[model samples]
Target chain A: MTQEYQDGNALAGPLAELFAVDVTAATGRCVSCGDTRRVADLRVYGHALGWVARCPSCEHVMLRLVRAPDAAWIDLQGTLSLRVPLPPA
Target chain B: MGIVSPGFRRRRRDDDVQLPPGQYLTEDFPVLSAGPTPNIPLDRWEFVIASETGQEYRWTWDELQELPAEEPTVDIHCVTKWSKLGTSWRGVSLDLLMEDVETTADYALAHSYGGYTTNLPLEDLLDGKAWIVYEYEGSELAPQHGGPARLLVPHLYFWKSAKWVRGLQLQEFDELGFWESVGYHDYGDPWREQRYAGD
Candidate 1:
């Protein structure tokens, strides 16, 4: 267990398949511990369950994504708020 | 179609046996943590086994070291499709830890130092099925890898072996943990490819 796995930034590729903007760079606050951090900094665990992003402060799951053949389920209950940056005009 | 990145290829050992479906072999052990590594002093660390009715059993670091320890070599499969074969660890067996505890609970929730939790069937933890591992690969388990001590349940996916484990709370009924309540399966079986809720 010496190797460090990918961070939340690894979610950008999969998230881009759904949203127009890059979600990995977004900022969010953990609902459980109230710690704010970039989505990219959240610990990302990829498994058969899909992508799970957890708060680095409290270990509370901030997001869960499960993409099926025709649909996708995104759960963000652990996140109090998500701020997605917009492209500069 | 997905493009294969340059210099990336699945590594395999010639002696490798059958790997579970959808898994690749890896010689390197990956550290996956939901939170920052917790810094707990040995004197301040204790392993607790508590029943739902509030009967508690506690073991200090030194006390744990005095118990019988086993060094088992087993193959561990992570939920992320990485399997490391023939890994060795030294720890006290759950059987020894639960020897005196009288309980009818069928489920146990492992609580960790970083507030991480994972639930498992009581059967999955007994009968030499698991251990509270403090040494890995001839060295004290690293904090990043869930030391002062971590639960080692090799039969299930790595997630079930909660890192930085602090205690086990026996429950009468099944209750989901951090991942189980989310999208991950309640009983994560790597062999069955049970990674999601419906799988």
Candidate 2:
């Protein structure tokens, strides 16, 4: 397959259902490859199931969001660390 | 439940068309891929069924056209939760494709053109549960929709159907494919709601 993934910005609406903060701007490290980058910079793959964000360098899944009838499953098990940006007071 | 969406314009509209668990009917077919879609020219296109002994049964685009074709109207459920009901397709049945081959393998890992793969029990690909479909909705299947041909195992989740399919390797081991190796379920059954590894 070619490198035809959507930008992490495409993840804003879906991730919004789970987090108040805009997670797309959050920087995180991919556990598989140790590449750190903003969530908005990741390569996102959208399917009928939901959005799967992969590490841009390693192509490993860093996050996946699949929703069921009454539950939403946001799996970030592939992440090592996440640093969400906050506003200065 | 009524299949409701905000101005969905896909295709068929069947009111009260009962859907599988957690699925919403879509009128238009949505195209989603993990990477780029391969464009295989008709001359270079080929389909192979690799037996456990390394025998590759191949069919060229022209030969495939010679095979008896069947038009199947079936419902498809995507892992993303969209269900398309009564979709029409034309293809050769797996039963016919396997008639000449002797295979005792227990599992199949369908390989696609663009490095995509999906595993299934060999039995799941046989007995008329699957096909090598090249046409959808009475027209030549589009590359975006897995042409020149793709595996059609509609019973399992659509991912298990394997888009841009090129070959089916028969082996004794249950080797996981692209999605299966990820967090996606090994045997994706949409009705059972098996979408992830634990589910």
Candidate 3:
């Protein structure tokens, strides 16, 4: 049994339409475990059931996303805070 | 209609067999996984079914093959709205595996090797409804396709037929698995078009 998962880098493509900034470079704090890390460092797991990015420290679900033909449902109740980098004006 | 993703390659049309509601036929068995593919060596692979009473029925890779097996050709429907028809699989029926194990449980939670899970009512897993398939299309199942073995419950949405399957835990009460807890329908019946919660 392999306990491997894709890093938060994979979230880039799925979240691109929702955010103008690169979501991967942003950081999120896991509500369950209180672990803070870059979105690119979280463990991302996705399949036909849809995409789930869990906290690397506690495996608590930090993000949940299900995509349809025209819409994507994303739930982020597990995230306590998300800090994103802003570009210079 | 949804907005088409840029550069999304569309699948070819082939509607020979009748499909369930809202589903289109897919000629290829697309590889989909919740995580990295589990690398379970045949020697280390196993299957376990724990009854509500704590009795465990275990089947190792070798032992699983020693039992009587069947080749079934069935149509599979995915909650993602893709259906594959007339797919051939080789494996032992769940009816044979659950013949002796005692359980008053109403539901079961299937646990996978890569920490993924899905739940089902025991009624949906018995009779001639499910199997632990090890081969697909006459070839050894690949790792990406649930490798050494996977629970093949074609009647339900494909998610219930978990890939990288490891074991099952029978429950006396309703216990939602990973997908079910995350808003997907609890009992994913493709024919009924039960894809999301409250559907």
Candidate 4:
């Protein structure tokens, strides 16, 4: 079988619409497994509902995004913290 | 609908007879996950079979390799509408894994190394219908593909085959899994196009 899944880096486009910075370049600490990795390395699954980002270490869902017709839902309960680098002023 | 990329082209083979409804053929194996790629060392890996009643069985990575394994070529259909036919895998059958376990439960929850879990009827895992595969296409299964071990249940939608599987917990009652609770079909049958709850 082919490897059709993309990394968290693939979320840059969708994430850009929500955050001012590129979210993929951030680092996320998994709340369940306690492992930390760049958001770009997280496993990403794209579906019609939204983008689901999972922690590679424990496979716990760290983030869930649902883009509705008029609104969006973003859940980060699986993530203990997300470190996005600030842009230079 | 989103913008269609100019390079997007549907891949259809002339001899394709196994494609499921609403699915397209893909030569590529797409990696779909809800989390990060777990880096589990072989020495730390273990497979367990447990019952809600407190009985449990455990198998280390080496122990699993010593058991007899089968290489079956089967088609896999994903709930995401991608089907790959005749994919080959090698692993110990579920029959062998459950041979010594005694359980009266009618349902099971497959727990992965990561905290991911997917529920299924106990019967769906027995009768030579499933395997905990560690090898795919003649190589050690890649971590992205649920390496070390992944449950293989080709009859159901691919999501039922939990990746990076660690153990099976027999339950007296049915429990919804990560995707199941969110609207994906509980019993994913590709032939019937059961991708969502109402479908």
Candidate 5:
């Protein structure tokens, strides 16, 4: 069997059921403003099933994720989900 | 343009608009498209997923309804510093799209028009964790945004979630796409801040 995240869930399952607050065990700090937000709030926005969120205070938008404990070096081993945009061509 | 740093006081009007600490102008960013502008059209579009065995699943206008759909508000971070939030998208779920397809391999490669491709594990496509979005912000997704279809992997760094999605092919070995091949991290993880060819 493939090693699974804590939920043993894959990436394409029901959005909410597969990725609840438990998935985001780690914390994500806003890259822009530097405020640390809960992984769950950052992950879901708009509504319960929302995928994005805007910081109520700083207004800096962030790509949310369940914190990856071993984020120090992301290769194929880690689950990389950064939403940073591509630089201008 | 720069982004405001954390704790920076906000002004009511354009006062806050001055370059923030990390923000940059969109014009300075890379152009995302299918290919040369002329051959790509908003009306003509296609998305497919092929198993390592060569079995293929294709989506067309009429067949699109056969799959499941969803609306998600997401924050898209480019390797560049512009973070756009509250973006909405609708499309067939990757899990629903690959329901009938069989894959013997452990990995898959997402391919697009401009020689863009990204490798992902097979589990990501089968478990309903992602989507191939055809619509954005309540509108038909535009060409610049990988209209008709773009892979949305809310889990992995957005780059592995290929845009301008044309087909998905199961692969036994990992292959790098445009950004990955160049210098972006193979898998982009935001929390860790992995944003270059090599982290």
Candidate 6:
């Protein structure tokens, strides 16, 4: 299998965190039609150190950035963050 | 990535029913959801494959018909799950075309008139899995269907086999096409289910 992009350890943190099974999943709603869809369905393109998520339904792409990899959570005003559920300790 | 939904075929609640595979006309089926049609004639058509080094081969509607034709009955399983099985098509063979041009590139990009394009490696293009189609089910091809010509690669998800194909641009490196630029995988293989990138 071909390996994915690993040039910057920077993306690894966000990818792992975003894809973590337990994280509360987030959905980006279509601004025009009010259709709800998974944020991963949104087209993601990196801009500098940050990323933008574009809605496929309405083509309304949104941008956000988090400098620190591990923090409580990245602040997204209306969008919900899918958080991983912590295992029993 | 969203779950690559099970192919559009198996989901059909109607189990015993089947549609003979081949290009279907809009007049017969009226399935507008398939996509829009390109306004072009079946007779006045041509296909060109150009190498980056400026070498080119052009086949007009008449010139293409002059070549030997093959009739293939195959099942085309679209990633969308609408398998049109037992379809028949007649067109030029990849081997015959390769004989005309000396490709210095490792890959090729399928270029269509409506700015729709897709890429394939030289190995895949020559693998006998691909064909350039012009006639469907023995009838003159309709416009909604890839008329006059289209590329059919059965092994991969159907879209990699572009519709309304006009020519091919040989590339030394990989270049993403319409769906690939969006979220679709660069190389769409049905077995691997590489429908979307990062899946």
Q: Could you say which candidate leads in TM-score?
A: 3
Pick out the ten consecutive residues of candidate 5 chain A with the lowest summed lDDT.
A2-11
Per-residue alpha-carbon lDDT of candidate 5 for residues B1-199, written as tens digits (9 for 90 to 100): 3586787875433233443234443422244332232235544656777877778887775577556688877655554455454467898787777777876788888888655678777787666678888887788876655665788886566666676778888878878755464355766665466765455
Pairwise lDDT winner, candidates 1 and 4: 1
The C-alpha TM-scores of every prediction are 0.79, 0.73, 0.80, 0.73, 0.55, 0.58
Q: Which regions of candidate 1 deviate over 4 angstroms?
A: A1-11, A18-29, A33-61, A66-73, A82-89, B1-16
- Taking the tens digit of each residue's C-alpha lDDT, what string does model 5 give over A1-89? 21111221222232345444343433445656666654444423221111233333354444322222332211221122333233477
Q: At residue A30, what lDDT does model 6 achieve?
A: 57
Which candidate, 1 or 5, would have the higher TM-score against the true structure?
1
DockQ of each: 0.16, 0.26, 0.35, 0.15, 0.02, 0.03
Q: Candidate 6: what lDDT?
A: 0.60
Error of 4 at B149 (Å): 1.0
In model 3, which regions exceed 4 Å deviation?
A: A1-25, A29-35, A43-47, A54-62, A67-89, B1-16
Candidate 4: list runs displaced more than 4 Å: A1-50, A53-62, A66-89, B1-15
Q: Chain B TM-score for each model?
A: 0.92, 0.91, 0.91, 0.92, 0.75, 0.79
- Per-residue lDDT tens digits for candidate 3, residues B65-183, read 99999999999998888889889999999999999899999999999998888999999989899999999999999888998899999999998999989999998988888778777
User: Model 6: per-residue lDDT, tens digit, B1-199?
Assistant: 4577556455333344443233222223122111234566646567888997978898887888888877767766554445555577877777777777987899899987555678888678774677888888888666656665788777676777677888899979989765565556678775565555654
- Give model 1 RMSD, 1 decimal: 8.0
Candidate 6 segments whose C-alpha is farther than 4 A from its true place: A1-89, B1-36, B42-44
Clashes of each: 0, 7, 1, 18, 41, 17
User: In order, what are the TM-scores of chain A for the candidates?
Assistant: 0.89, 0.89, 0.90, 0.88, 0.36, 0.45
TM-score of chain B of 1: 0.92
lDDT of 4 by residue, B31-131 (tens): 77765568899999999999878799999999999999999899998877777887999999999989989889999999997677889999999998999
Clashing pairs in 3: A70-B2
